[model samples]
Target: MSYGTSFNYETILICLVAEVLNLLTTFIFYQVLKIPLFFDTIFIVAVVFYLGFVPAICVSIGYSLINSFMWICKTGFFDPFIPMYGLCGILIVFSTWLFAKNKSDFRISVSITLLYLFLIALTSSMCSIISGGLIDYFHYKYYEVTDMMNPIKNFSEGFIIQHYPPIVSYILAQIPVSFLDRLIATFTGFGIYRSFDFFMKRR
Candidate 1:
């Protein structure tokens, strides 16, 4: 995949718009409403369904970098670890590409759509587990940062840690959360993709 050729000026502009809208969506859900779920990948998945992997990956990386910068700007805390979560976005891009790409049509059956969402959610859950584990490993092994950003996730991990190993606890804590988040993101992403396709076709 020659991403250099794929990433033209138009692609860059679209990715920038995706990143800005993603940032807005995330801020609305996470900061304004205090929602724990990260719907940040909706636009990235949409880009995957609409454009392709390269453009979607660009949006994903942009989301991570822009969010990291925003976090530092808001809190004055320079945690370079924020961009590590972009692994989850890359995972979403592939999952969407494989299972949901170009499948956004009004003629598609509800059962099949549900199945696609479930499969994407399952894959995304695994991705989040792996990414979170790596981030936590690096954080504990190298950095002195002890602050847990999400108290609910921290509490869930703490509770599960008593019964299972820390790794298992971490995985368990993230599965439901990641699953729900991806489920919503995949559904909304495809819906938006379908809407755009429909509008364009009408035009």
Candidate 2:
């Protein structure tokens, strides 16, 4: 937590790598698979299971084992942080799934998706802010870096005030992305059909 107490570069590196991998995986799922909007809700939920329950527990334990072998590793374990990240992933997934499952029709689905998307964005931003604040607190306590606390506090306040506008913008952005994904999916079937026709003619 402390800046002066020898920062865990390895842990930060691993987390950044994991985040990049997750982002790429998410993009592939959304763009390449082109899953239907209705089905995306379910897919997102399943992905959360993989990220939270599977990878976090597995990767963290593995990292911890390696770290424990090194005499210089400070924390020497990873179970504590892994469970927190896993729990957050579970909450995000479960909330989206529950909201999606409740809608019974197209109109309801659109309405719920918009509402849930906004809530998710807001909650995600706020949670990040809060976590940053907690990390700052630890940093200040451990390293006597009072300046770090101020920035975190400012970020938390700003997020609380401005979270809704960004959330709304993100929901609006998703409207087009969802439509495009489905359109691509439809076109993929057409392309396959045309290819089959061409092959038959050649034969």
Candidate 3:
């Protein structure tokens, strides 16, 4: 929520790097591999651990906006809904900052870090479901994907057809996938942050 009163090229550089890495991660996982998981938030989470809340949130927003722009360029149509998922990244940053800000070293212990990562995964998954539900309601109310290739989407549809609420269905279907996705992202991001911090301290 607050960045100390300072402006520096190094901060700018860090944000730029995080933004690009987030974009590339998204592209590789969601586009090239056609994976259902969104690995894009890895660098954003890393930024939160490296810098703080403000820089990480800025990177998240920048990544979302750039992603939307790229989608427009590729499809020749803008999907406003694409950027709305930035909320997921913001939630992840806030959750991570809340957990790590109190610790002096932020290393804590492996067990504690794993617990925090699991909570983050749960939190991010719920946030994503809510955000996605809202976007669907406003933008794609009657939308239906006929040939859903993603297993999560396919599973979600099973619940939807059973007269369960779409939002609930989405939450149930995505929790497992999102939980695993976020666990990997936060774990890897934390490792990257620790490595970078170690090298910088040695310098």
Candidate 4:
């Protein structure tokens, strides 16, 4: 199967605006939910996952940039946790696009979800590195400039380092939440599309 190689100007604008809105809703939803997952994941996957490669990439990049900026605004500086949203977005989009494009004729099996869940784990392992093992490396760089503010961060870093290697433990710790979240996101996205189709049929 082939994928579109370019996005039109209109497509780019739509993705930018829509993703911005998604980010706001995500922040609000995350505050209320007890589950440990990014709130926008399902919406992003639902809107663009079946649109194939180009749209998925566009939404992922746009969403990630805005999410990073929001984190900076809230925390008064950049946070490692922010960029992970982009990585997860790409994985979720690409996985769904690949499955949809390839299996255009049939229902996706249970294996597809499980396989992408594994991909989520692999991508998140890299998140530990990107986040500097829960900001351990950046602590010395940014924290000093911030005047060692936020003792909670300092304590968490100490706890992470003292008991287990920060990077390893960080990755292991996130797996369960990320796995469950993405699984539900993928299926919930399917339900959303089904609802849309039903409504259109009624119309």
lDDT of each: 0.73, 0.36, 0.72, 0.55
Error of 3 at 143 (Å): 5.0
Which rank order by TM-score, best down to worst? 3, 1, 4, 2
Better of 1 and 3 by lDDT: 1
Top candidate by lDDT: 1
lDDT winner, 1 or 2: 1
CA error at residue 19 for candidate 1, angstroms = 1.3
What candidate 1 gets wrong by more than 4 Å, as runs, is 1-10, 102-108, 140-148, 160-163
- lDDT per residue for candidate 2 within 27-137, as digits (tens), equals 456446643221112223322222223333333343334333431354443333323333333433343333333324314566654555455445433433344334443
State the lDDT at 43 in candidate 4: 55
Candidate 3 lDDT at 17 equals 86
Candidates in order: C-alpha RMSD to true structure: 3.2, 15.5, 2.7, 5.5
lDDT of 2 at 67: 30
Question: 1-203 in candidate 3: lDDT tens per residue?
Answer: 45421448988898898888888887778778887777878888788878888888888889878877876787777666667767777787787777655545446677877777677666766676566545544443444433322336666767889989877776676666667777888888888887888999999
Q: Model 4, range 1-203, lDDT digits (tens) per residue? A: 56643577855665666577677766665654433455566656555534556776777777778767866887777766456546556656665665555533334666765565455434533442344334543444444423122213343455476786655554444455455665666666655655655676799
Q: Rank the candidates by lDDT, best first.
A: 1, 3, 4, 2
Tell me which of candidates 2 and 3 scores higher on TM-score.
Answer: 3
Which candidate model has the greater TM-score, 3 or 4?
Answer: 3
Pairs with backbone N, CA or C atoms under 3 Å apart (clashes), candidate 4: none
Model 2: CA > 4 A from native? 1-20, 23-46, 49-109, 143-203
**Number of the predicted model whose TM-score against the real structure is largest:** 3
TM-score of 4: 0.64
